[model samples]
Target: MAHKNQFQLLASRRFLPFFLTQFLGAFNDNVFKSALMVMIAFRLAADQANALNNLAAGLFILPFFLFSATAGQLADKYDKAFLIRRIKLAEIGISLVGVVALISGSNTLCLAVLFLLGVQSAFFGPIKYAILPQHLRKTELVGGNALVEMATFVAILGGTIVGTILSGASDSGGGSEWIGGLIIAIAIVGYLVCRVIPDAAPPVPDLKIDLNPVRQTAHVLREVAKTPAIFYAIVGISWFWLLGAAYLTQIPSFGKNVLGGDEPLVALLLCSFTIGVAIGSLLCERLSGGRIELGLVPLGAAGLTYGGIALSVIGGNLAPLEEVSLAAFWGSPGAQMFLFHLALIGVFGGLYIVPLYAMIQERTAKALRARVIAVTNIMNSLFMVVSAVLGIVFLSLLDFSIPQFFMVIALMNAAVAIFVFSKVPEFAMRLLVWLLSHTMYRVRHEGLEQIPAEGPAIIACNHVSYVDALLLAGAVRRPIRFIMYKPIYEIPVLHFIFRTGRAIPICSRQKDPEGYARAFEEIEQGLKDGDLLCIFPEGQLTKDGEMQPFKAGIEKILQKTPVPVIPMALRGLWGSFFSHKDGHAFTTWPKRFWSSVSVVAGKPLDADTAKSDHLHQVVLGLRGERL
Candidate 1:
């Protein structure tokens, strides 16, 4: 089937209602949680409020630990559309209970409602991630995720602000019955929207449902561990939540005790942070060219650490404002600096998360994608719980101020990022390419590790620009033999470059059957010589900047050579001066001396699994949707 357009995907009944359902669910959650927090800070006795607030936070997150395993199983076993509708209905019931608690003005009852909301969210977790691949195309995953994240966080900011305002209004009136009513109304809307979500059939429809959470959780863990990359991605995701939960839990306390800001100011701080996250999420689709680019993970982590340090320094410089204005909310010497740090945190937070999410979706088997997401949800919950406890320790035992706490967190983040990148050099390599492309033009790669970086290999890339082979040569440490078109090999000016590089040329079977036969023999000889041969499987440059189908010539070569095939993707070359775009080569140079380009290489695929169609898809995934 042809891929759906982005707008169509966005507007479709399949995605929109589920989007709203999740959005409203997130919003209602923050609304109640924030409202309760406001009550603890402003209305209850200091000791009593602290105890109640801490308990509420713990109870809410407790469900993730207890129910996430069950949730994953259910998501993998049931139709997600039906499951989501049920969960939304559950939310309505929970919100109604919240209404009764609010009317009674009982803090205990309100806290219970918070716990129940968390429970509902935990159940929705697996289905939330599991349903996407069923509805969207491979190319749309990153953009879709970005949109979802943007919506979720926007809901969070709005819910937080609305909840705080509503709680404050009720306190002034000596009651908060209206806050409960507002939550119930939102829950109703969430249910209605969920009913409209498109149906997603169960992946493992006949799979057994594990009623025992402990055994089930263990099983899920084992399942995930089967794929090391997926497991690490889960760890990466959980650590991010740990960092976020730690940072977010401290914001209100910091605003009030450290910055001496009021409730409204706290809302402002949250708004800025969420806005930064929203903007960053939107940018992910563009920056990654609508694919999961794990390289951004390190970049995001760097931002988080720096932003944390910046916040810490600004907190240390806390001073009273000389003047206050609407702009001063952000510019008020104390608050302005604080908001700046928060915004930076959010920006980097966006960069860090969007790609990890895309990676999880892309790498996992489609059948288990949602279950993996549920695993992530559980991990996030566990980390947040750990964070809350550590936070308390830092605040009480260590006598660390909020800013100092952030500084410590920032340092830890740097350490973790370095470790993860070291383990996954692909991220580090991409970072190198990203930096180099932004700095130099006409960059060329050669030697490619003297052709045998490890073993016999066949390197395949799309035919795009005149300099593609050069760029690949420059980036690879191995020496490689290029299989060029006959004409390009015979070109007067370029022939010497190819000859010096030891490139081989071949004509099509129709043009010269004997020549094609001889070229395959040469490739086989090169493989026997333990040399790496790079072939452009697309055979010719794309006239419209889209990948053409593989020419099947490589199939014959691979059939004969029997070497590992490593697919490479070259991006930002289509619009370059030497590209087939703009009617011809070297006709239109970029305005800048250094145009951004990327040469992404995937891990080697065994000759057994290196079918032409599979290789094509892998290349497309690597090139991303934009190419």
Candidate 2:
């Protein structure tokens, strides 16, 4: 049975083992990387340490660009469970080599181990996401992704803290042995946990492997481009990483130069951001009501902008202090605000990324999912590289203050978000619908599962308010093509959503025969194209919070394209802000916020039996005096 709470998945055999395996792998990677960074800082000259650190970062990221294509192919062509086991086994060997290098005090060998670990991670990345849809139900995708994201950030923080502590407690090379031991132990445990992961059969067992990275990368990019939604989702996801990298890379400097703080203050700032991201990520499942809610993406993106700007402002206004401890820094003016905005950035970031990941997995074809994810990985790597270079250009070359650089990033994020939302209005449309249903009304859905997951179906619902279509769009899992009245469809602001959503706008035959004919023609084509369509069979909103008689237009539709008709109803929307209870929608103040509302879907009826009067009664019964 699927768990209602995402946390409950931790107790399930299907998810727990796999989750642990990945968690351990991430933890181990960070522990090793952080320890190595600290060791270099302590033992080497400043310039040498800096150069090696940059090299380490680049080496770790290099594998994603070089091996992601082959990794994607391998993941699709083999059982994911088996591949995970072998990968974990390789990790064990790599950890042993790392131990030997640490014991010998060889930085060269240590860097080599880091590069090898990067290769291991690159191979694991494709399998990490591709296996999700195979193991999880559609309802659990958002929750699963939420948990993964939360675990990832938490693990990173924990590993960084632990590694720093371990290194700090030792002199010179003493911490190296402990780090090596911990890494090896984690790798072994990861292998053992992965052994229990349920089998995920290969999606394309006979697919040929493409060893040519350049050629395969081009191929996979082309494949992702075939689906504009998936491509844009990848782009959005990549942009998020770029934004995140900028914040993470600059935090230490922001603390030292901007806040005039020491290591403890840096740790505090990191904690604020990391914890915020964890909180935000966990909230995704709840805020989305356990669905892949794309609306959160825009909300997150906007929050990031606000948070970044807030941080920049706060940082710019701060008076400088010299080598202050965490406590001293906390006493600084604007310190609390800085931390809050940092956390806010993380929170919104969580809201932004989880849905995009779930959407990619849900939409991509199984045969090509891994390869597409590989392309995503490549994009992420490319973006991170660009982010690093931009950081240099902005701060180092241009002599811009960290606060100024942050403002640049925030404005850049805003621009990217606007461009993406314009190209993919579905994100913006969903955001509007989500806001309307979540803020203006407390929407409860009933029998929504009656709507087929994939098929051509007609939804005939009573129109109680002007915003009924938007409310229904928010409630339903599938994308819906609303057949809207022309005037309502042409309403400003709403018109963008309606048009972008591909709502078919119709007028009375006497008003505009051509438009009416065109609307029907579009409806026929939409159904033939296998879209889930919704029509307000009442033809217009009720004047007195009552159902209007269903129009014959639905019957005409069925005669031309006979498909299943699912009777649906909107209840308790009367006297609400969008309703006509007080003259007209938006003409008067809303009597209350979060008004109780319900959307009910009745069992499907064969098109032949779904007459106008019958659907009206069915909808009326479903509403059941709730208005």
Candidate 3:
């Protein structure tokens, strides 16, 4: 069957209603929170209001730590659509509580309402994320997540604007009735929309509700730790939330203290971030072309770090200013630059998050997916809390300005990224592969499905360039451990990627007997472990545009672990950048920028027919006179 377009899901019964429901939920959360913040900033005591703001943020996040584990159990045990409806209806009741808080002007009651809604959001969190894999196709996950995140931040932008506006009006002798009415109205509409969401069959209808959040969290966390990759992904996702919470939670203070702007300018700062995130989110689908490409994580880290530090450096030395016209502010030498840096952070954030979410959905088993997501939520909440504490330490204790704290956050992102990448080298491998595919060369893959989707396989291809491994890695959806010469594997910049990718480094027995023996041992173990390992059967990169004789090492490796031999061919890499076609690679200019390249995988050769001579002819045929 032909696959349907992912965006089309938005128009169908599967996605649109769910999207609206979540968007509204996020919108409502922000609306009430922002309204309270506006009141505290504009009308309340300065010190007391600042303390309340911090407390408000903590109250909203506390429920996730307390309830996400239970929420995960419930999602797996019941109908998600029904659960959403109930949650939305609860939202209405809670907004009414907000009515009490708003009408009486009780900061205490408002905070209590915030905590209750946070509890509601905690329950809603697991189902919202876990439902996508239940409805959407695997290929559509990235696009779906992109759209969902885009709508979410945009809703945040909406809530910030609308809620602030209403609260502002309420403050002007309207007696808070205006804000109260609007919030309740929004809640009812959310419940109505959630009612239309399609139902997904519960994965474990008979799943016993584990009422103990602590025990349940521990058990689910054990399930999460069973898979190292998924656990690392959870950590990465949590760290992202930490960074986001740190930056976003400070927008109000950052604008006022650093940019010298008022509430209106704070709104503009958030709006820029939301718009930038939306743009970046939408760009994910086009960039990934429907797959969960983990490569973007590292790239996003780079942007996030760069943007944060740049903001810190640029925002220093600026004096506070009175509330001024935005037109005048935008004309200031530094305002737009600050916004640009903030926006850049959001853009990279979108790039970072969508892929990680899709990866979790794509890789995890259906049974444990929701529970795993819950663990991620719990960790995210914890990290956000840590971010808050860090903000206090840096600002109140260490006497750092908000802009200077941005630099500290940037360093935090870098440290976390390096730590996670060290734990899972696949991220590093994909980054190199993605960069090669996107920047210096455009790879057109052919006959990729001819290779087994998952299994032990040895791919033999002509190595036409120094980057042939990268091109092949980028071409195939699966990760491949390549066998390369030790010298090449140890190249200064490329070494880190090669080592992270677990590329088997070989040398002639005469050159290094121990290394050569270790290479074969590793290759045999990898194939036994059901890994895809790609090797240049010619044993080295072709000096000219022609296939070299297949190396005898392949025969030896296959003798030890005889897997299906997949023959691949690289065409149009000769004379291009990274190719030794004209002279030394990287020493010569690319024949042209963005040169076209193709990697073709032919049918897997049966063991009896997988002789070196026969497979050589097959690859040569696939190359088809490209030389």
Candidate 4:
């Protein structure tokens, strides 16, 4: 399957209506949130204003803790189209209440409506996420998620910009009355658009609603924990929220207190972050080849910390804390660096989140996905709350400055990333592949989709380098069980990864007859388990960058399994870093940096026609006589 740009998804009905509904919902969310924040910052006393701002943040998040579990059950129990329409209708009601509160100029009433809107959003979260797999084909999952992320962050930027501008209008907009009506209009439009979204059958139509949030939330999370990858993806995703909430929550204050600017500057910096996320989110599809490339998650975490630290120190005794015009701010030497840091942080955030989200969607059993998302939403809310608490503790109790707080978060981010990636080895595996494929060589994969997305198959390849297995693993979307010689599998550095990946390590029959017998049993069991099995038919790496005689082991395995065999070849790896160039690999310097390589996959062969000799020739032909 050839990958298409994310923008192509915009033309489809399966995506557009849901996209508009989600975008409008996010837009309305930020419009109200930004307006309230501005009021708390400007119209109230300093201490009370800070208190109210934090209160507003808590009010919006509390509903996620209270309602998300039940909402997940409801989404699973009902048609998503009907549920979304109802949620939008709830938004309209909430907006009506907001308008009344705005007219009355009552902060109490406004906060109440904020909570109600949060409740509406809590119900919408699971539906928005779980409905996608129902709408898009499997290959489109990553692109769909990337587009959704792009829309979300962009809407956030647009709404924040408009909300901040209107709050300063010195008219009814600034006073909140007109802005409330605007939110009402947006809510209605979202509802209308949601009407066009096709009905999505509920995953668990008989799901019983359990009203106890704490118990149900625990149950949902426990179910998700059954799949460690999905669970860790949720954790990684929540950690990202922690980073986001930290930056976004502190940005306005940081801008005013440290950067010597006011609320408008805060808006400007946030716009920069949002734009970066949009660009990064769209780029994720291209970078990952429309697959769940969790490798980028660690890269993103590292960039986030790096950018955070840069932003923290680079200001270097910036001008005094007072209002500065945009002209003066732009002219300042640190301005561009500061903006770059913020945008870089956001870009990495996009990279970290898009793949993790797609992975959760792709890996979870479809019937329970909504509940899993609900569990994720609950964790996200919890993480954001912790971020708020951390900020308060850092600033109020520790008496730390804003930049100092950032320094602490950045340091903590490194620790968190190490821990999370250690827990999920796949993330680290992909990271290795990404680093190798991107740094040492550029890998151009051909006919990758010929490898079936599911079922048992033999991935027979002519191995040329130590990294050949990794090359195939990275290029294919599915996880492949590699059969490697015991000596190579026991290489000190990669032994753990091979163990984690469940690579079948085989010893020669002459060396250990029993071990060799176990190897065949393992291979048969792997195929019986419907694994995608990869084998180097030569039984070892190429000594002269040429194909060795085909081993009989592959024929024995094929005779036992009788599965379709996919012929693949690794070209351009002959003189690469891991290749046996000039004697042993890594004994000398790499002859080339950023070398080019390719993995050519051929059409799957019928079980009846997949004789070992024929398969070897097929792989040679696909290798373009480079063999």
Runs of candidate 2 exceeding 4 Å displacement: 168-173
Model 3 vs. true fold: TM: 0.92
**Per-residue lDDT of 98-144 in model 3, one digit per residue for the tens?**
99998898988999999998999899989988999887877788888
Indicate which candidate wins on lDDT. 2
Residue-level lDDT tens digits of model 1 in 147-260: 788888898789888887888887568447778888889999988888888889888888787778778777767987875557777887888888888877788777766656
Score every model by TM-score.
0.74, 0.95, 0.92, 0.90
Ranking by lDDT: 2, 4, 3, 1
What does candidate 2's lDDT look like per residue over 280-328, in tens digits? 9889999988888999999999999999999899989987775477776
Query: What's model 1's lDDT at 339?
Result: 82
CA lDDT of each candidate? 0.78, 0.90, 0.84, 0.85
Ranking by TM-score: 2, 3, 4, 1
Clash total of candidate 4: 0
Evaluated at residue 122, the lDDT of candidate 2 is: 95
